[model samples]
Target: MIALTCLCGQVRTELGKRPDFIHACNCTLCSKSGAHWGYFHPSEVCVEGDTKGYCRSDKEAPSAEIHFCEQCGSTTHFTLTADAVAKFGNVMMGVNMLLADERDLAGVEVRFPDGRAWPGAGEFTYVREARFIGEG
Candidate 1:
């Protein structure tokens, strides 16, 4: 299992296993946060501690919900809204791999998603195969 925590360690999430895939998104919020995502099923994740949530929505894309440490303000994980959840199923969740332990990151591939110019404008791209821990 892999554990993801906030900078202050106030919030934590346990991933049942290494993610099937990891990717960096260039969407507005993602670009601002420089967040790289590791996808998992909600059943495969165990979240502990309290967190504050921020929900963002607009015309360009589906609304999203992000959860972060209440004290340190570090994003721990995110999920889709109700509409999106109905469409995609609540099995999917995205955890911030940037907060995971070093040993848990080995052999993980990092992909780049062209969410900046989403839809017809661009395509998903591969960024790298691995990341150095604490590089966040």
Candidate 2:
């Protein structure tokens, strides 16, 4: 299992398994938060502690519920809404890798996705690809 906590340790998250993928996105929200997302099913993660939520809306997609530590304001992870789950078949959780312990990142590949032009974008322009800190 992989464990993560907010800057103030007010919020925590746990992943039952290694992530499917880890990637940095250039979308507006991602850019602002400076997060490298580690994607997984919501069922594979557990969130604890007091978290404040912010729902971000997009014209082309469902609003996502972003949760952050209420105390230190550090982002923990985000969940896709029920409306999005219906379309996607499951809820996708994007956990912030920055909060993870370096040892938990073993064998994880970090990819870059060009989300700045998302829906209308032709193809992603990957800037870098590498195994994360603890990856062998």
Candidate 3:
């Protein structure tokens, strides 16, 4: 299992298997928040802590919700909307790399999604190379 925790170790999560995909987003909130995206099946994961959800009605797509830790103001995970759940049971976990341990990211793939042009709602670039097996 891949374990994830907040900077202060107040919040914790266990990912049952390697993520289906990992991504780095350059969107306004993502870039400012400094989180590495890890996508997985929500049903295969377990979380423990005080987490809060935030949604941006103006820019959010049909299947995504941003989640953050209340105590440390750290973005922790993102859940897919109903549409996405029906299509792919993938939940995006916004892992705080700084807090992840080496064993927590074993066998994980990493990619980059060009959320930089989120303002213009342009196309996004997803990298196929690059993977993370340990804490960053």
Candidate 4:
């Protein structure tokens, strides 16, 4: 199992299996979140601790909920659409690299997704070097 946690260790999550996809997004909201995006099956994840949800309004006045840690203001996960849970049985978890070890990130793909447009998202820039851990 893969474990994800906040810097202060107040929040923690246990991933049952490896993520289907892992990458970074350049969208306005994501750029400010300060963590890598990891898509996983929700049923396969177990979350602990209190996380504050920030819902972003869309054109229809609906909102996408972004989950962040209240203690450190760290973005740890989010769901852009309600159908996401039904379709993928998964949610996006912002893997806290700071608290993870290098071996924990092995075999994971790191890409830069263009958040300018999502759903039919654009291509990503492949990361040649692994920077998830050992950075702060």
Candidate 5:
């Protein structure tokens, strides 16, 4: 398992397996938070410690509630909202892979999704070509 932790060690997330790929999105929320997201189901991992959850008020319907380490204010992960749960069910969650050591994720593909242009509809397009974590 791979463990990702917040700066103050107030939040810890365990990834049961290496993610196939991680997303570095260019949307407002992602860009501001500076998170590299690795998708997983709740059953696929474990989380410890208290976190403050924030749902964006700008969106008419926010899909996720982003969680951060209450003590250190480190962006930890995000959980789906009730409405999102109705749509995607409980099969999806996002872990902030940035909390993990980059060396621990070496060789994992990192995708740059053009979330800025994503109309909250269909598939995401690439902002740039994908690259592996340890690329020189």
Candidate 6:
């Protein structure tokens, strides 16, 4: 199990197990927020504390809602929006791997998928190749 906590200690999430992998998507929101993502189902994780969520204001129907710490403003996790849930049924949740110790992430692969040009419903074009968390 792994635990992720925000800088202010106001929000915390416990992942039941190690994530399969993490993504570093190069998109407007992700790029600006500086998030390294580890995806899982909500059942695989437990969250505590209050977080404010933000969906893309630029899109008519944003797919996911980004969550952050209410106190220190640290990006924590994301859940699918209601519109997205209706289609996808809350199948995915994303945690900010940047909150964990690098050593804890050890051999997990970090993928650089190009979300900027992603079609939003299919596989993404990888702008950069994948790398393990600890590679020299």
C-alpha-based local distance difference test score of model 1: 0.76
Model 6: residues >4 Å from true position, as ranges? none
Better of 4 and 6 by TM-score: 6
Residue range 1-136, candidate 5, lDDT tens digits:
9999999997899998988899999999998987989999899989999999999999988999999999998899999999999988998899999999888899999999999999999999998999998987
lDDT of the structure predicted as candidate 4: 0.63
What does candidate 1's lDDT look like per residue over 81-133, in tens digits?
A: 78778877787888888888757887776677767666534555433344534
Candidate order, lDDT descending:
5, 6, 2, 1, 3, 4
lDDT by residue (tens digit), candidate 3, 1-136: 7677887777898877766656666676667767777655567767799889876676546556677788887788777766667776554444444446756556666667767654455667653446566535
Winning candidate number (lDDT): 5
Segments of candidate 1 deviating more than 4 angstroms: 60-63, 120-136
Lowest-sum lDDT 10-residue window in model 4:
127-136
Clashing pairs for predicted structure model 5, backbone only:
none
Per-residue lDDT tens digits of candidate 2, residues 56-131? 6555565567888889889888888777778776757899988988677766778777777666537777655655
**How many residue pairs clash in all the candidates, one count each?**
0, 1, 0, 2, 0, 0
What tens-digit string does per-residue lDDT give for candidate 6 at 25-47? 99898987778899999999899
Supply candidate 3's per-residue lDDT for 12: 91
Q: What is the lDDT of residue 104 in candidate 5?
A: 89
Top candidate (TM-score):
5
Show where candidate 3 strays beyond 4 Å.
60-62, 82-98, 118-123, 126-136
lDDT of each: 0.76, 0.79, 0.67, 0.63, 0.93, 0.91
> What are the models' TM-scores?
0.83, 0.84, 0.70, 0.70, 0.97, 0.95
Model 6 lowest lDDT segment of ten: 119-128
Please list all clashing residue pairs in model 3, or write none if there are none: none
**Candidate 6, backbone clash total:** 0
